[model samples]
Target: MEVETINVQEAILLESTTLSSRQKNEMNVMKTKYGKTMENSDYLEKLEFFVIDVIKTKQMDTLLTLNRTDGNVPRWFVTGFIRMPGFLYAICQLPRRYRYTNCINLFIDSCEILGMICDDVAGSRLSKVDFNTQSDEHWTLFVQFIGVIYREGNSAGFKTKLIRTLRLINYREGEYTSFVQALFKAHSRIVVLRIDFEYQKGIARTVSLSEALDDLDHLVANMRNNAMFDHMLGYIFKVEYGVDRGIHIHSVLFFNGARRNGANHIGHAKQIGDYWQNKITLGRGTYWNVNAKIEQYRQKGICGIGPIHWQEYDLQVNLLNMVIHYVCKEQQMIRSDAEPYRKIIRKQHFPKINEVRRGRPRTIMIASVSDQLEVESI
Candidate 1:
């Protein structure tokens, strides 16, 4: 698939509103109070400040913080990044006091106030969002915040094209991030495959991301002696056309036996790396070298107490949450860089991945069920 190109965030200014001199003075005092209250805070506190920002105007963005606090981003920066149309992606690691449902509802309420109108966040066919989940162990809600609109229909004057463009980039990116994070963490161990330097083509070479993955799929199943080992191989990846590195892939591959079959050590790492090099690279000439790194995260004891001021904001680490974010970090990949190659990359690079590839499901568990020829799970 071609890389998506979105216009970066536009510069925003708060809409002018009529306020009495006394009210303006009160806001000014609160501005100073906010600075002193939240100075020298860490990631946890930044999260709290985000909720406070939500509570301040009962929303965020519209460059509201511009008039209030001097943003010393390098030192006291917010915990997350901002996207197009001034949408704030704050890292919402819920503390002990607040539950995931409560935090997310607040975030949903605040973020829905964004776009041009209150209902602008409403889907074409849907209105509300249901983020309630049974699994709290792997939850990390990245709160999306927007500016508050005092007047209900204040957005009627918004141009049609501008409004459509904002909605597309705003929610689409959020949904993509959420889907990727959920899918990756659902698996037990995620193998991060970094396709470095080897398969990069200079001119007529159409080595796409899918091509490399297809090669890995064949080698992986073949690693299990090509019996019924197709179930052991699985992968999900994103291609990055770096400014200097050209085209490369950042992918997360899964194996059913990786955890119980001693796949954590470097011995297995080298074996997987060697398969990519010898088996997958044999026909690609001397230029084909595969660079692989296996990232295994331990979900235990990953939480820390809340920041000094925001002590209630403690957040537990989700399984593979870090790796999911790392692989899905398309924010750093320049669309302009990838745009030059998107046209040339073709479906031919993918071939018939499904017929030849094997994938692992979230519910699979390998256990002894009588005498079986190979591993089995229910």
Candidate 2:
């Protein structure tokens, strides 16, 4: 597939009316609040110092805290980074809650762009940074670092894109909810599975984003015809480009729960994952069995995988809110030069209306009492 690379700077300037008046007003309020507090010179100076310190000491966690409210960074500043070319990619590499040092290398690379750290120093700063310790000063400077990146990266353009991107995210979320509802209506129960298809670290660095996407598209097309997916009900796939992971896909597969007969959902997921790894991509790809980690999600109270009955309202809600929403979120953030409304999420195999049978038609019977009375009169 020929993938078009969007020029981030140019795309941000495109006009969009996706946000409602209320949303626009709210954004204006947020911008005004932050604008009054920090000047460009101060923001840049703080950012430079913060980057230099983090580079020298390798304190990456201080950078992570900028996303939190207690970190003292403005909300707009944090949100603005979402539109930065590779910011989301780096953020995705970080472990949840920033508990570990997964993306320190990427962080350093991003910092290098600011010209705050010398090229020679960046290579030596690859050691792990302790996420558990942070001083008050670090927090203050980290906020400045975040604010500077936004301000220097063209704050006005980022804000415009942020508004448009948020509106697109909301609209896509609604579509996801509706899609899930339709699946439930068509089938009494669905065996939901989540699988992540990604390239090996070395392979990821070797291929272009478009090439990766093409390989994934081919794999998915073949899977549809494969016997393993014979009873498939529906599926959704999302392509994301990350700094570390490169081009990858987050996918959800829906199958006929009755046919599965409450079988090992994780096992089924493994088969698909293995197919992507060994057969489809021919060892160039690796897959993560998201269902295998069900317990983790369960502990967090967001487990939405496994066989879910249509009548089970809570499970259905969880599936829609947690699973579906996740796959559909950040769709607007896809770095594509094609068009503003290009669809990054691919959905297919939905049950047709006529194919679905809902609780067999109710039987009706009428007594002929009037006929009996007429016979007696005769």
For every model shown, what is its TM-score relative to the native structure?
0.31, 0.57
lDDT of 1 at 283: 40
| Model number with the top TM-score | 2
lDDT score, candidate 1, position 302: 31
Which ten-residue region of model 1 has the weakest summed lDDT?
A: 304-313
lDDT of 1 by residue, 145-261 (tens): 323322221244423423543453344334333433332334343332223324533421344434544654455446456422233334444544332233454444434333334
- Compared with the true structure, all predictions reach lDDT values of 0.32, 0.55
In Å, residue 268's CA in model 2 sits off its true spot by 1.2
Q: Give one digit per residue, the lDDT tens place, for model 2 in 34-130.
A: 2322122222223333333333333334445443333333223332332222232223332221111112322444455544343223222221211
List clashing residue pairs in candidate 1. none
After superposing candidate 1 on the true structure, give the runs of residues whose Cα lies further than 4 Å from its correct spot: 1-233, 258-260, 283-319, 332-378
